[model samples]
Target: MNSSASSVVDPAAPPRSNPIRIGVSACLLGREVRWDGGHKRDRFVTDGLGRFVEFVPLCPEVESGLSIPRPTLRLAGEIDDPRLVFGDSGADYTEVMRSFARARLHTLADLDLCGFILKSDSPSCGLERVRVYGKGGMALRKGRGLFAAELAARFPLLPLEEEGRLNDAKLRETFVERVFAYRRWLDFVAAGVSLARMVDFHRIHKYLLLAHSPEHYAACGRLVARGKALSRAELREQYGELFMRGMARAATRGRHTNVLQHMAGYFKKQLDAASKDELHRTLDDYSDGLVPLIVPITLIRHHVRVFGLAYLEEQVYLAPHPKELMLRNQV
Candidate 1:
């Protein structure tokens, strides 16, 4: 899950409760998750994302009892390939790391985590590009960290990143988008999604979905139309496949903001010129990075709830009858 986002209490952010749960490398947040008990302490992570995400700091090694200020570890074999060993002791900790990871996975299961920011180059948590050792003092291919490997195996659909990558704006946007999208999906599942519920769920996710795949968006609408013909089991399987496929597509700010602008048209007649113009300006400003897309989208959604057109709000996809389309009222 990679297109970026989130909500928390920050000066620039709208106040939010139940902030998205974000799994972080404990050391990175000054929690002393490192071998020697010193923390990484990232401000951008602590201040920037921490403002929105409920940080779940984890130190796999500490959990594994390797003690702080210990000797560094490395991948002794291959990445996604095998064997993790301690550099000095020649002690293989693969089984131990893997075992702890499994336990950690169970703990993570209940967190309703939207995403994770792993420590870079960590044997336990690096996301990508970790050094894989070949022979003595030799580095092989770059691969994922130990805990990261296990975590990815467990939650293949969850959004993840490393501190290094968050520096890039595009990556940040993708991570943000993916995490919230995951959150929305979780909300759908938690509500016991059915065909109608699924349609409603998709409606809220429409703008973000379109940013990923316009074609998929259209196809999803058709699939929703097939709800009556398909059973819940069938729909789940179908939608799950489509969801993964759509996620594989990349996201672009220009494309998203543009589609969002078109969506704003749904409210034009119902709103005054000042409100319309203001929203349009807000959308445009967000496109330029003056603010986040969430701010304007939230604004429109508020107006949408107040106004009563089903197409104007979350009802656009939730039809009256299986054959009754809410968008039919669209001007």
Candidate 2:
């Protein structure tokens, strides 16, 4: 995954401060734990994204005492009541897997994981469109893997994705953004969340939320403003849920362009005629699909430094994850 030369750090960019903890399917990290003792190592995940976060690699089958090169397993019966069983022998291991998932997730709950990336199309790890087979040997692609289903049900708000889907630029950006935001929320709580702190949190993430869903931004603001009536626990729980949910929506190019325009306005007083024109042109190029998102974002960041715009400099929307990952360059 470490394909390129070392990345040159951006001076205006924030220091690599936050360390997001994420769970990855063990095989994706190049562990030979698959059914045939082969691994689906994802270089982008291990080399690119791995630079920013600490990965907790997990293998449900191996951890559940299943031997490598074991008989292939599949989900059988109705979609709602599918059993994890050997495909050829019809040997049921539903309880074995479910029991392992339950105990394993209980341990993970305390790890404060921000997200998980599972192996795609795996009998025990896939998330979307997994095949479910019936007694008549008919198959439907509507099933979720046993371990992945448990993880989703337990931590409904945690960002989760398949290694295969991360190939898509939009989904990759959305997941990485959510992971950082989720960690920020966790850090807020760890610092002893207070009314004033929550307000500051909402303020910093305001534009970021607007890029995802303006309605959610307004709803979150209302939640914070009406915090006087709710208990501290209630405020913490409700606001956390809304904040994460808001960030979960994929930000569209139109929405991003609007946010860029809004952000550019902050430099109106400081930028000279030439500088303003250059910034506007860069943004237009990005909006017109002629340039990557990093172009406009870099310009805005430079202005933020030159103009001493402390507020915008501190805003997480500008640099959601590590620039070393070069995530924005792709999106």
Candidate 3:
């Protein structure tokens, strides 16, 4: 994690009661299990996000019976259907890796994972832009690792990102937000599904959904409205799909500004003229890139408490992830 992000958790902020379960590349946690017996340990994944999440680490190459300090492997052949081959020996491990991944992912599905963090540019775990060499020995950075591709195909809605990409402030924020949200959804389902409970979940996440995609928010609202008519299984399936799709979209500045303005309306009858002016100015500053999102969010949260806006106080958008991550400070 960046130093700025590391310092954001308020001392008095309510601690999360439940830990989010996430899959991660084993080497990211400082395990010496890479092909060369060296780890690509990422402090952001291990020290920052790790504080809030329980990682289920796996090293495909090592777990598949490959020796440490083994000959390096590379993806070769067609981009869509690459073969995992030793860099120097031309030995093939494609089928072995695929079979191992299929079995491992099936096991993971039972683990109730909310997200996954893969190692970047790994032959076994990179999520994107992995180099695939052509028959003539030229490399193209358009392929995903075999295991990463399998995991995605198996759990299409599961939040997944590479440790390398998590270095970006925006991507890191979105990934952390989605993981926590997914964990909440899982807990909701585990508590037993009901139309009334579905409505309650939708209500709390309204503005959070709006920040990502207005169309998805509308679709999800409509889905909840039909809750009493649809069977429990059908309602759960459809709602989960829409919820995941909506959060999968990056929350852009324009969309967030609109939501922030809408939230500010709740405090209009409660704020004095000066306070109102300050709120609007903060929102405008955030919208104009002159201030971080945390500025408007912090002000709105204060107003919500002062005015006792119960509904607004409960909104997940106000505290999507742990404040300690300081994700909004970056965006």
List, residue by residue over 147-182, the lDDT tens digit for candidate 2.
999999999889999999999998999998898888
lDDT on C-alpha atoms for all candidate structures: 0.70, 0.86, 0.87
- Count backbone overlaps in model 1: 16
lDDT for predicted candidate 1 compared with the true structure: 0.70
lDDT of 3 at 99: 96
RMSD (Å) per prediction:
9.1, 5.4, 5.3
TM-score of each: 0.74, 0.92, 0.93
Model 3's alpha-carbon lDDT is 0.87
Please, what are the lDDT tens digits per residue for candidate 1 over residues 116-211? 899888877887778888766687558788889999889877888888877766666566656666666666566675988878766755765677
The alpha-carbon deviation from the true structure for residue 225 of candidate 3, after best TM-score superposition, in angstroms, is 1.8
Clashing residue pair totals per candidate (backbone < 3 A): 16, 0, 2
Index of the highest-lDDT prediction: 3
List the lowest-lDDT window of 10 residues for candidate 1: 319-328
Give the C-alpha miss distance for residue 233 in model 1, angstroms. 4.1
Q: If ranked by lDDT, best first, what sequence of candidates would result? A: 3, 2, 1
